[model samples]
Target: MLKKVRTVLDDVLDIERILGKISQDKANPRDIIGLNESLKCIPKLKELLHLEDIKKLNSAADSFADTAPVVELISEKLNEEVPAQLQQGHVFREGINKELDELRKLASGGKQWIAEMQESEREKTGISKLKVGFNKVFGYYLEISKIHQDKVPETYIRKQTLVNAERYITAELKEYEEKILSAEEDIMAIESELFAECCQKILDRADLIQINAKLLNRLDVLTTFAHLAIQKKYCKPALVSDAVLDIKDGRHPVVENLLPASDRFVGNDLKMNVDKSQIHLITGPNMAGKSTYLRQVGLIVLMAQVGCYVPAKKATIGMVDRLFTRVGASDNLAGGESTFLVEMIEAANILNNATAQSLILLDEIGRGTATFDGLSLAWAITEYLHNHKAVAARTLFATHYHELTELEHTLERLQNHHAAVKEFGDQIVFLKKIMPGPGDKSYGIHVARMAGLPGSIISRAKDILNHHLEESMDQSGTSISPEASKQLSMFEQQEAKFKKDLDEVDVDSMTPIQALQKLDELKKKHGL
Candidate 1:
């Protein structure tokens, strides 16, 4: 394979050669030369592919056709080097058209005669400041300074007057102008016709040219894959028929290359199957490699399917038909959509489209809305993926909602993982490693402190968090202290009695005065 690739690389011309030739108006001598050189290599490329060792190259080479006729035609007509503008002439080789050559000679001779006429007019008019100039609007003119305008002859017809000069055209000058301009136009017209003919000949064989170009493109891509594999020490992944993905020590391909030598990326293992661990619920504090882990798994699967080596010690990838990712959020304010609305829309797209053989990576799903709403949506999404009758797609869900970790106990196919971290008093060290089991705490306050939040804000946040936890525990009937549990129980009894009294009241049938009297009595009895 390497030998075959090297042979093609040596024979193929750069694609830029033919790209310029493809355009009708812009094709020039350089383009034709490039096309000719490229066409010369096609036959040689086909012969090289026929060699016994070149298996993959044979199929692509068979599709290429010989375009030597077009090459010969262009070579026979175009000059060695043509100017950028076709009107300037020399666009075609000598003898390609006799009339074009004669017109070119006439235009050249007229330019020399005009120069001599300028000198003769100055002498005859006796105006030392007189000069000749040409413009598109007025083909040619003789100019005299305002101070010397009185010296103008009656034979010079005034064409235009400027602030400080007078311009005129003589009979001799006008006749010369017609001849010169006509010859120049004729030369350009003929050259355009001839060049168009050359381009048409090339376009006639367009199919053959396109096929060869495609073969060269495939060869270039294969060579690039070979180079990247050698440089990055990538290994071929084992593709299996079963719906399972197991990678031992997989590294994020792009991230690992971008890190400095001293802070090399820490590789992690990913093992998931549709039957046992279809959904991986990852929990961790901010910036703890959860997003990176999810992305790397998706990328590795994609790379393997496209016939490229993966960045892992070993990998066995099951075939996945589709891949979906809902990774980030941003509001489209102009379209009247908030960040949360956008997040929901993307989530909806994934749930509606993903199949059992699809791989999904959802990072911080439902995070753009209120806490409970976001958590509920995230929880429900996980449930749907786990229990969907027909499609149980492989999913990697990363979220800060630690409440989701409870799903593992009830969900048969759900498993829990966390980005491991170690704490030293107020300081925390992110291990950047994925491990089994859910995280006990998100350490949001610690993460906030690391982000440089004010100490007062961090302290107050901790207090609020503690208060919330206590309230949650008390509500769940799991209070730690006896006194608190008794207080809550008493409050519940009073709440129940108040509801019972309200339920027994017959205020609708009573008169206004009686109703007021009953309300006062109930308020007094309840110690209102």
Candidate 2:
């Protein structure tokens, strides 16, 4: 459809200046030619629009007033081959104006008249080689060889003397020059007047042409988006009044398009409502697609809202009054703000302005600062977005702070989701699939190794990580309250005793019944 439209409208020239000229009544044959070229396609495009079932598209096409009259008048009056500049004549039809037709005949026939005179003079003077010539200094002259100087007619007035010939103009020749020049001047003046009259006919219907022009632009965009949807296999999202956003098999359109043909993007699902899953606390390691998932949801919502098909298998969007996204990081050095400062400013704006009807997308908030500080900020922000009534917006928060996932048990509206990963020895593969539940580890060191970090650096980092793990688990990435200290000590003692007993059990000598009895005793002891 788009290809047919482009082929049909290929003759339509840019009529921006023509439109301006029509308003001022200063349009020339060239501008009218451009205007006619554009308006003539209206009927053809209208025929194409009839093939579409969309009511808006058909109505816009139907709004085109009968512009055939304007196109006909311009086509009839303007010559098939018209000069771009208005002052050059031969722009109008011969019979349109009597005076213009007469002057045109005189101007056009001047060359033949000059040729006849050259032949007549050569015969009368017996100068067989005489030729007619013209130049800026001498308007028109008969050039006679010096050998025929004696035969030159007394009626000839000398104009110029060349090395090989003598240039002379007769009285008839001088008089004809003035008349032909006057005819050309009159021809240009009449053409300008005639061109203006034709332009006036179009200006009378300017409003209708402007309406059709706007309609064509609207149709062009619609058809292009239609083509894009068909090629990309997009779905028409179902927009509703409630505050629920459910998308199935959603993929990021841009990422999908940019991926190499051999690789396929993994699709993910998202469901959000004010009820149970308003805020999704997404956790995963670096290089996972948590940020991509956040942006994909934002883009899908925006696309659906703007009447474009969303890149998903199915989508049901509850119209959001406001959508806020802060997905990536960049420092505005000229503005004297670091990346973390900018992140905070954006977070502040979302916190202060977002409503229950808004959709918020945030990625790796507070990740630029110290780990504990960043984790604390991330945790509190999630709690605020979930608990505050004014800011209880549907949100997708992607972060690497795994400790924040504990909020799933605390906040009713916040759900824990992570980009799933698979591990094999020291290497891990990012599945790029968002799944329910908290991620066990960030795999920061594993990601660093994958990034081509030095082996020594990776080994030292792992050593430091193990040292931190052995020191005290609670004090590492998450804080424990003083109130839970006794509970932690008792649990730690129970684990120690359970390990000691499990070590003492000799599997080689124990029978199946003995093993069952030993596990029951250990469970009771561990409970104590």
Candidate 3:
């Protein structure tokens, strides 16, 4: 059982690099129809093992990877598959069903038997109804009414000796009393044993039910794989196709459908032809389709490896031991780590452990840091993935820093890719298409403007940029001598004084009259 669980964990978890589609929620398949919903069968997978006719179904289970499609095709032809699966007390479901039935019958019989026994006691004692119940130092009992006292026989009276304040039973009544008391004991004993057995049976049946549930879950997984194959229009690949990941006509499944036809995706075709080679650097603009392309690759690999047909028109996949994704945002409030710190920890985990057969998808690897630090780290990580690590696992590294694109020239078996974009005057539109080569420009300011920034802010940003550009040029042409250092210090002192004077004005509290007085005072102080 543990081994089977381990197998499932490998396939179900770590979804970063498999393919471009989210796995359907396995536990609920009611909303899903056809083979896509087949995954729902996993909870009942264990049932296949316990049936008396499971011997006949062995062929179906053993050949599940291949000829199981025949079962689906046959079911489709006969139209009996669904009803058969839904029935309770299926040969496999009967063990649990029978146990539950037996328990219910035992409880019902126990109640009925007790009721009849009580009626017999009432008839024998001439006690038509239960009037009062009492427990004395001797035994439990039902008391008779004064009107029914005459119904007692002479033998009961003759044997009686006045032993109580009211009336007492003779030896004759004692014998009858023993009979009633014995009947109750007998009924109680039978009920105790019967109920204990029922409880035990129920517990056993519950265990069997749970086991059957797990088996059904496994069955659902198999069916899901078959359904995926049909949808992708591909045959299930042999286990030997273990080393191949071929995706033909692959589009980002989620994106392609949601986007308009005019803005629809251009598919990505990547065949990792080299063994021990897994890293491709992707450089593009802010709104370019790099992230989408990476996600597509990851989703595709995930689907294929899990034995499901991929979203691509055609694909033959390999087993990825682990798929690690360091994409998107994560908040780390409890850990007291910032967004960038969380990103770094995840990246570190991937870099430290990823192997040749592992799939790693990294998006904007170092974008959480300062410009130079982030770019440098991104560049180094790309180099490490390309040159140092086991390349057997595939990697898709996406970044906006174009300088890292230089790696394509430096590393063998390394390739450059980017998402395409179109420029419209000052407005650059993202095409959201993956293509070969790196992007040439960083449209950070352009994107910012498009997101709604005032014209005045844009102009101010441009002026600051120009001033910094000029300062850089001068710094590169000159040396920092002692005289220059002294001048810099004097400039800093004067700037400090100017800032102190500016801070002296309390703009928030100043009224209109105070503002006019301050303007005149400023004009006199500066001789304006």
Candidate 4:
């Protein structure tokens, strides 16, 4: 029944858009016609739904309204061929009003009126060659041959003198021409009044029409979802009351659709539980589908609750009351607070509002601030979510801060996942696949190299990284502390500043004594 209904409803117009255009006092002919046509589609739906074969399904037909009266009223008055605007005047059936019909006839028959005037004037003047002519330059004129110039009356004003004839405009011709020209305005005035009256009749039943519009919209959305589910090979998700979100081979709906015909989006699997695996700590490098993985799980859960098929091989979702996301950097409009402040504010909102039933997706949560501050906040937020039951929502957190992955052993409910990457010497490829366990490396410099950075900058960055690693890590590189990393980072910053100052010294411009004094100042500042 729904398949048949979906096809018939293809003709249903956008009644909601049409209703928005209706004026309080004016009847927009175009909008009214749209409303009428949309309502007319209800009968087809009613016929399909009012089936006795299934007897119990008859209740669905009761949802529709009897919009026939509105449809009939609009059809009776609206012209088959409408003008672009009401003032242009063909918006109604010709015989709907007597005055309107008379005005239309007068407006359309101006040529016949002018032809009769020429005959009457020829009889009156006895100029056999006299003719009534009209143009933009000399409107409604009497064109007489130069031979009959003597017969031109004092009442006739010579508007133009031609090569072999004279054009004259008389008071009578001007008076009759004004009537003919004003006939169109009169016709429009009548049509406007009639159109307003007809619109009022329909507006009196606006409530019923609006109700039907909503029902039809619901029907349309369900049918579209049905068609897409079949076309995209989506699966119906199972709903559970407990705290678990399990999806197998789930794909991102938007990214999948946007890929080329030859390319297929790689599907990933996710399973979470409030008691065992409430939080999946995602660690991956840039552009390796971490964000896409986070968004897909959240979207699939949402789709299941919203009564639609999800893009997954199989899904069993715990209903989510609130879905909170802190995915990217954004600044406040006032500019008083920094972007990091904005990130904290959003994080605060999610933390304060989210409950055990909520779903939270945090992508690179601490990337907006200093590394120490960011890592601290990311670590503490994860602990707060795990320790506090009130806010212990199912979370999918993606970050480049690999240190946070160490929390899986500390937090009982936290699990580790990464977007897998493959490296060949200096080159790395984002495999676009999610896999279990924490990532081996962030590959930041490698990602920068892939982004087309200059070779010199890339080489310098690698040198700085290696220097930091050597200074901060243990000899085996198996035991590294954040405290040592912070100290080494400060030392690196100070060293770079001293190097910049030494490189900027002007030996050619400085006197010997002043150069000695500058060297003493640098030695004192650097504790040399």
Candidate 5:
């Protein structure tokens, strides 16, 4: 099937290029030839479309009108041995116009006359330096040098004087010059008019020709898609008009091609729906295929919508109205916006415009700010996306913030999934596979060691991480050490002082504006 498609494409002429020539202000003979050649291919292409594998191509080709008459007229009228330039003549056929043919013959014979005159004058004057010259400004002239000036003839009428020579014209030379120039000019004018008439004839059927050109272009693209499908082993995805998207053993089309044969791509299954799972919160360590999984789903859905087969074992895609991706971080520093600000702006655009049928891919949504602030924003955004009544867009949210994994328990349509990894003592292997549930831990130190960071820095980072985790557990009502108890006591004292100051405010006798001023003073005094 692919071979047959390629054979048809080989016979297809670039009809668009021909149309471009026909639409030019001054269509040349080469343009006519190009149009004739393209028109001849229409019949062959139409015949090839009869194959069973090319039903779409046949439908498009059937609409094309037979332009054989136009091709015949151009081929018969225009000369096959035309020059690249139109001004050099020989553009029209010999029998197209009698007067133009006669003019060309006269122009050809007159060139011999000029050459013969050059020799005849040299012998008659007995001055070997005497010559005949022609230019646009001076039609024709006989020249004699200063050394031979005494040999000048009486019938030579002085036309002009040169620094070292004299120029003269004869009555015979003037008569021939007029006839040759007039005939050449008339021949060019007649050929141009005849070519213009041919162009107008082609333009008269321009609408039909344009229709055929457009259909041929469509056929070419469809044939190309068929070829790619066969070469890549892509399957036709089942497209449905529902809210469910299911794909079994889906692979990233571009990544698979770029990988070496030894490192085969690991395909993953994806299933999402508006009611069951609208948002999949992905948590994993860096470079663990989280982003690749998100992008693969988006690409598969897009490919299916374009009427092309998708790179998947078995796939079914529902109609998606709009697709939005906020995968990477970028800053508009020149525009006075930080990375976080740009992130928020894009998030706002997605939230405000997305519909229930939209597909959204968000990667590390809030990683530009402080830890608690970023975690809080990511948590809130996930909740809003899952629970928003008007916009329940199917979302794949990839984040390094593990705190987001907690949302799965609270949000009904939100599910937790992570890229699987294998652990070996202190070292870990990235499986590059998606699985159920949140990741057990983020092996940042292992990743840093793999990146070749200094051992001392890695050691210090591990110490700091352990300390923070311990402090977090102590603050959450776990057994506290003496130093943590001291910090907790200080916090208690500050809270007590704030409450006392609030209780002392006398709002009953104060004006509303005065009460605001008094509250502001108290807040500053207590460091609230």
Candidate 6:
């Protein structure tokens, strides 16, 4: 993903735009922040298609080493330098800090002399010992021992403590303790100041990183723009290919490098002669590389939009106002709409909004419906796209509807084309080649045989198709007008007749068995 973005960026900037600048070797907080901002807006860049994951991957990469470099450096410096001062002060402050440790020993009776004095004071006051604290002005003062003390010894008296009269300790001890504490405070203050300074340093470098990131993010887009300018530089508009994508060789960036030397792609040029007056209809059997051709065109347009080198040699791109795709269809099961409904909705949206500068690829656009309905809808959609919606946006509409070839002469921009195929006696072969003309037939029976269908079933299906096809050919010869409207009318008439019959039936008086009998009669009458 990173490599893809890098390629796109490289394509956009080109050699001249970059002026020999090298890619950044390291990532810092500034880079991370800029990436974050780019990611926030990438989802809204309609010009690029299906690049959400690419943007998200870069966003995650940006965060991988996004620590503030300055802060880390400062912290490292402070930790190394301040330890020496802390060690020196630890000795001077030891006596004051260890006072509790000494008191614990005295309580244990190891200091027999101090224990005797403590016992005497406890006997007079009914207490053993007390915890205490003090500061600079007041040395050390008793806490629990405060209320019990009567006359303290001079040695026990606090000569230094905080300015507030809260605790007490000896002046000699307080003086050294205060100096150690003050020094530690100064070190901490310096550490904090340095960290803040580091933050500022990172911010200072932000502009440069942000600029670099922007350049990288927009690299592909800019490259495409530049490439187009070069391609169309001084040529007359009509001199270019006729609304057709004519590349002598083309390769898929994501797949080209994976092929072995012997199997390496000799890029294939695509010639889609779609113009203000031409819509090429692509018809072929499944898995014959029809989808790959469609994707190649779509990817090319997207690359051009983003300013990158399209996967073609000597490419000439036409302007596309918007690109709409109704390629893959699925269901909105959560919304209770079936797969067919979802497919229709997307197809409707594309037909409603597409403009002449738009590029559209519709793969099996109406396949989710009944055979005749699907073929009719596909034909109408092709006609609409060719004659109306996008007279200029080159389209590659692939479908299984071979009958739609009749529109080739009727519609100005409508042309019939198909993926090439080979037939061996009764066997069929998918050549995966784009050629000029329509497929004479779909090898459904041949495909079934290839899929290991029983020979007996294949023979029976062939017989059934041959019988029906013979009758159809006799009825209308090679040209069969669409049967979709007739089927719809038939359904409407049936529904009306059923409703009329249903109005005469008295359901309220019928028993369970009677109702069942009545339903059976209705089914028989309608051939349900």
By TM-score, the best candidate is: 4
Tens digit per residue, CA lDDT, model 2, 345-395: 999999989998999999989977898988899989998988889889899
What ranges in model 4 sit over 4 Å off?
Answer: 1-4, 23-27, 50-57, 115-153, 158-168, 474-528
User: CA lDDT of each candidate?
Assistant: 0.84, 0.84, 0.57, 0.85, 0.84, 0.57
TM-score on alpha carbons, each prediction: 0.79, 0.66, 0.51, 0.83, 0.71, 0.51
Q: Give the TM-score of candidate 1.
A: 0.79
lDDT tens readout by residue for model 3, 395-484: 888887887888777777667777777888656888776676777776777776776676556556756875776677677876455466
To one decimal, what is the Cα RMSD in angstroms of model 2 from the true structure? 13.2
Candidate 1, residues 1-528, lDDT tens digits: the string is 556656657656665456545554566656677677677777766777777555666876777766778778877888767676666678788898989889888888976887788889889989887888999998899989999878899999999999999899998898989998888888888988887877777777777777667777776777777777888888889998788999998989999999988997888999999999999999999888999999999999999998899898899999999999989778999999999998899889998999989999999998898999999999999999999955689999999999999999999999999999999976799999999999988888889877877655776687699789988887897878757545667668877677557645655468999989988988888887
C-alpha lDDT (0 to 100) for residue 466 of candidate 4: 82
Q: Which TM-score value belongs to model 5?
A: 0.71
Q: Which candidate do you rate higher for lDDT, 2 or 6?
A: 2
Model 1 misses residue 191 by how many Å? 3.4
Name the candidate, 5 or 6, with the larger TM-score value: 5
Q: lDDT by residue for model 5 over 66-119, one digit each (tens)?
A: 787888888899877787767888898988999998999999998688888888
Candidate 5, after superposition: displacement of residue 156 in Å? 8.9
lDDT over C-alpha atoms for residue 57 of model 5: 60
TM-score for model 3? Answer: 0.51
Clashing pairs in 2: none
